[model samples]
Target: MDESAIRTQLNDAGYALVQVEPRLQGLGSTIRPDVLAWAADNDGVLVPWAVVEVKHRQVAGHSAALRQLATIRDQLGTVDHYVVIDGEWFRADRGLRTATPISGPVSPANGADGVLQDVSLATSLIQERLWNAANRRRHDGQRLDSLELFADLLPGSLSGELVARSGHTVRADRDVLWRAGRRALTAFTSQDKNTDLFVSHPAIARAVAELAGDAISGTVLDPFCGTGEFLWAAADRAVAASRSVELVGVDFSSQMIEIASSLASAAPVPARAIQGNAYSELPTDVDLVLSSPPLGLRLPTQHELLNGTSTKDGDLASIDVAIRSLRSGGRAVLQISPGVTFRANGEAYRQFLAENVRVAALIGCPRGTVPGTGTGSVLLVIDKLPPTKTFVSQLGEDWEDQLSSGGAAITAAVAHLDDKTAKAT
Candidate 1:
């Protein structure tokens, strides 16, 4: 039967109907369901009702259509009821139950638009999954087996393996799992506290990785790795370069750390996530460090901070930790608060940088690039050697546009820095 006829039946059955187009969002792939029906309250608030699939006529492969409907429900989530229409006959499947016939002429409410409602459904479904995952806790330190299952459902490169570590076997893909798990934690925590958790945007994360240079090899670390985005980006770059590197991520949030560990387990290279203070003793002699540490915090002294003994200015301290963690000629690409270049304590830090590290580049990021963070940020690249000509540039408000085009600004600056290094050498 035609879709209009199906819509009429649903409308008569008290549902607002709209056609759903296949579009990729978050973990869901492109899916085009014939129609979506919602039960609207008296105030016209749309509550998810059911998904409908319309087939022209009865075919021998009818079972495949039903399976496709089930996949849509699983990907879209929220709604559990689905209906399949073939010619004049209709079958409704509620959750895992068998499909049953509904006796009526299908009709849908006039002028019902499903686009806005579908967006709402997608957001609600993602939030629900994140909430459930955030609340689940394991006391025995066993690997998060559920995350391994989730990895299989997600797109891109991800897999898991149980490996021996610290006298026990653990899931190797914990850090890869963290890519999604940490987002859930961030969402849940943000809602609970009504505050923005300094989660880096994926674009910003990719830009930072690009700034680190694709030639990067050996060990890489993100001391204040919130959700392991930088580590993931670095891993992807290393894979593109056909180079093998070890990935290490550290974050104080146990939840964040757990997710990061799970995610790193699935990286193309050897990777591990640690739950510890960035101010504490970290792995030394690392080749590169890329991180966006939390801002608006103060610290007393760099010495006290590095020993994991001070929490005066965590923003500055994280940079100090990154600098100290690097090998003699290693590089660090850090996302720092804009104010770090002028604050009183920042002066001392700058003086330290001038005396020790080679300041490579400072790329300013536009405001709102970090979503909840209205404050602007800067990407600071430094090498553990004598000073060099510093290349500084503003990324403007369209920094995201630059990022989308392969972070041209950052790439050019890195190229200039490479030339400067070559001349100096």
Candidate 2:
């Protein structure tokens, strides 16, 4: 984990380090404290502050560990808070002492960087708790709910949304829910959305596509239109522009079409969802095409799709056909396995895209962005706009911090192009 980034965010937020673990001494000892940072302020007189020890690890099962932390706290007289940061893959309570339950829970719905996001959220929550606690005895009844406090932060409409789209009763303030939703757009995995019937992280998909220049003026087609997610995202962008999208969705499963059509009817904008052979029956003359094609892992036979049989032929071919069918100047943004970026077999396709179309940009999504999937998958933003500007902005100096925002890279890429164009002129 990038500790420097975490320190940067904390320092900027008015936190100062009082001491770190290595300074306190203890390595290879049963308790390995990877992080030790603290904040304190003293007026003309000296004031006391708290000490925090951070333990970072991957995997799960931390009950015994927390018990160990409790023992350490007892040995060390004055300690404020002890925290444990674990990877998202780990089960709860596997790192920190079970005593201080990580108060602010930032689910994967927010981002796989939940562990890091949890840290930021934890800081704010600690302050809020202290502030509320000071007033708790004096206050009367029914304080402002979190949603009501930060109503402005709420994104889109919040009425139809549930805390967990899977029908879990975990309720949250509307503001928290909104932030959670935005995270969902970027962080949700296919598994996380498996139970979602209508609402999924549609905004992230739409935002990424729009940032890559998807629009309604062009014919936007979705190749692997699983329940018409990308099509609906495109439609939302179009509707926001006071126009309707000329959208078409193709799915290999009739069952998916049925569910997608029903979902679209309730969408903010109308879309056409159809059942067809995604790889074989894609419509031509599309101006902009976007898809999160099935990786074919859970399909009847993974080998069938990868090897490409005469009957099934495979969706990859369908995607290729979609690209070929694009109008001379059109572009397609396809989500593919990260292996596509470096795989030797894809060198031909890469060359084809670079020579024929402008290989506009390659965007890498965070790990676990599409859960239940393996390590290498990304959203490939290919355009016919020529190799103009390739924006690749650093998310932040905090290399360890989970990405809070995107478009920074896109902006950088665009700026890079502009510089080149200016130089040429």
Candidate 3:
């Protein structure tokens, strides 16, 4: 079925919000399920209510279409699913349980026009296209060099090959790429999907950026900046703070640096990414630092950057680097493992922290905050100035809501830090 017919049937069946041409997952190849929907009078804060697959009246392969709908129904774990063929509605839910034929109502409601604009989904669609094109080329024996596919698909760098999904190379949307660039290029370049650790939630990036920007201003650096999400958030936050900020992102991955550089170049601030060992790239003049560096890493040599504190722990070393990189009164917002925060063996480090480190706040994040992983994590907001009181709050399962809301723990922590800064000044 056409886009309008699909929308009409969904509206007839009571779906108000719809997303078209979504790269519905858990399938062999890309499957365009036509429209995904939420109930009428209930965009309901964007909770999806049903999945629909629309077929044109004269569409062929009736058996394959039903299989597709059944797979999507099972994949999404949805109770309501439909295979609308030739204007007839067939429910695919029973197929998941038994050999039941597709069943449902033949009806039509009020629906909106065009596709729903979602940053996350739009970026995923781009990601799928880039991956499919690259995979096709790779399968065709095209040995890519470094970030060949990424370099080409980027704005102004589109060689047409990477942008061509099926037939001809079409116009690529630079805006969608910019918004969807939260994930590393490795997510598409890798032999498999990126590990959860590489893909962090954009909400966390925004929260950390706000925390850092609200506290300090001169220059913001993310040492392990993958795809520059933290820096992107920081630079975007700079617009409202009315500050002409400088952003610097460093990473060992060349692909990450290339993509980060491309994304940062379009920012309203002076932003860029440096490719090198992040530990060696920390500058002393930076005013603020924020990042979710790699977890569970170990260094061959001990690090002593955070006011002469020495330790071989990888993340600890990263934290120390962020601390030392700050100016005297500069601050940093970082994500560190929960175990490092409280350990019987860490009493010596605790003493060191009490004497040397000036922690400002500790906002514990809910599980899955690290993305694609089960590892527990928390945000550590600190100042390099002097010993100070630290605000503390633990987020429940509704971490995203708490992080985004104005009255949340992150906002309160910023207030505490601001108050502390005022008193010292």
Candidate 4:
């Protein structure tokens, strides 16, 4: 069997959570075991339980896999580490130079009680219902996508209302459904391949919130808010900073607006999501614009916010919506494609932006960080104040390290922006 098949087997055996290619750091470099499993602690919190490295029979031997597991053991400290060779599980020695054979099914304790594991199961179950709904409902001669189906399902499910459409009843219990729905949204995925949910990376969303500063109190807006992840993160940030902040998200998709609205209200901070075309009108009262707008897509000509802007489809057009919406001295932290950042296209608009907006900072992201997009990205931090010299840094895969209070990248970027803001003021 393949590595993925092995992971599934491990998960079935009682590992609450099983993941492949999990992002982890070893003593000095990255170490991605063939499979990683988690189990619940006393508090029902999911923690790393084991790392399984598979040495494929076709490809190689156990020595290399053993060495990698040894590194993980050294760093993670006593988390069970094992290597699978020829479909046999072997417990690795501390140094990994030696190992002993283990019994079959090396699953961790606590099968499904972990909070995250429960949530994952809930997501899977809910997703199954959504898929069934997709099979049932038809929209404009096409079935609604997974996200759209989720939006269609949430309200009725939450209200204890069931839909008897034409010939079928969507059986949903309020307690079981909405609770699962809320948790499911935390890591929701669309099974429908063609649908595009313009969501932001969680790490970048957290960074943007952190960069909003402790003094911030006015409105924070996400123009293309998908699922309200950024707003939720901002809410947490606001609570942490002890600031009274208003959060708003605008999306052209009504389904998105509905889901985002529910998500925002589900969190601690007060927030709202409105259905509006950002191209037509973005709220002008926004003090901070934190968004990851649709990349590589062109807005219709009339929606272009600035004069002399390029007609090309890229982040520049969506950024226009974000910048135009910003209040004076306001800040915008947005994701930009490399093409736009490098002036490969939209040079005219880039020039306009440079001349008019304060390009405060740029954070380069690692590959596969942004979901759905196969490419690495850059976070462009701009202010509505006068243009100034910019702060630039490349971020590692460990977002918490780079974006936290004392992290070099965030610290330097915040310092540069503050210095410029002070000078501008």
Best by lDDT: 4
lDDT of 4 at 304: 46
How accurate locally is residue 191 in candidate 3, as Cα lDDT from 0 to 100?
37
Clashing pairs in 3: 1-55, 1-56, 11-109, 12-108, 12-109, 90-103, 91-103, 91-104, 196-372
lDDT for each residue of candidate 3 in 135-216, tens digit (9 for 90 to 100): 7888999975435566566544222121212222222234444555544344554333353355356788888887884654
Which 10-residue span in candidate 3 carries the lowest summed lDDT?
Answer: 158-167
> Could you tell me the lDDT of residue 390 within candidate 2?
41
lDDT of 1 at 114: 28
- TM-score for each candidate, following the candidate numbering: 0.61, 0.46, 0.65, 0.60
Worst lDDT run of 10 residues, candidate 2, spans: 107-116
Cα deviation at 240, candidate 3, in Å, is 2.9
Q: How high is the CA lDDT of each candidate model? A: 0.63, 0.45, 0.65, 0.68
RMSD to the hidden true structure, all candidates: 13.0, 17.3, 10.3, 10.0
In candidate 1 the C-alpha lDDT for residue 330 amounts to 90
Once fitted onto the true fold, the runs of candidate 3 whose alpha carbons sit more than 4 angstroms away are: 1-125, 134-152, 155-177, 180-195, 305-309, 421-425
Provide the global lDDT of candidate 4 against the true structure. Answer: 0.68
Total backbone clashes of candidate 4, pairs 3 or more residues apart or in separate chains: 0
Q: What is the lDDT of residue 229 in candidate 1?
A: 76
Better by lDDT, candidate 4 or 3: 4
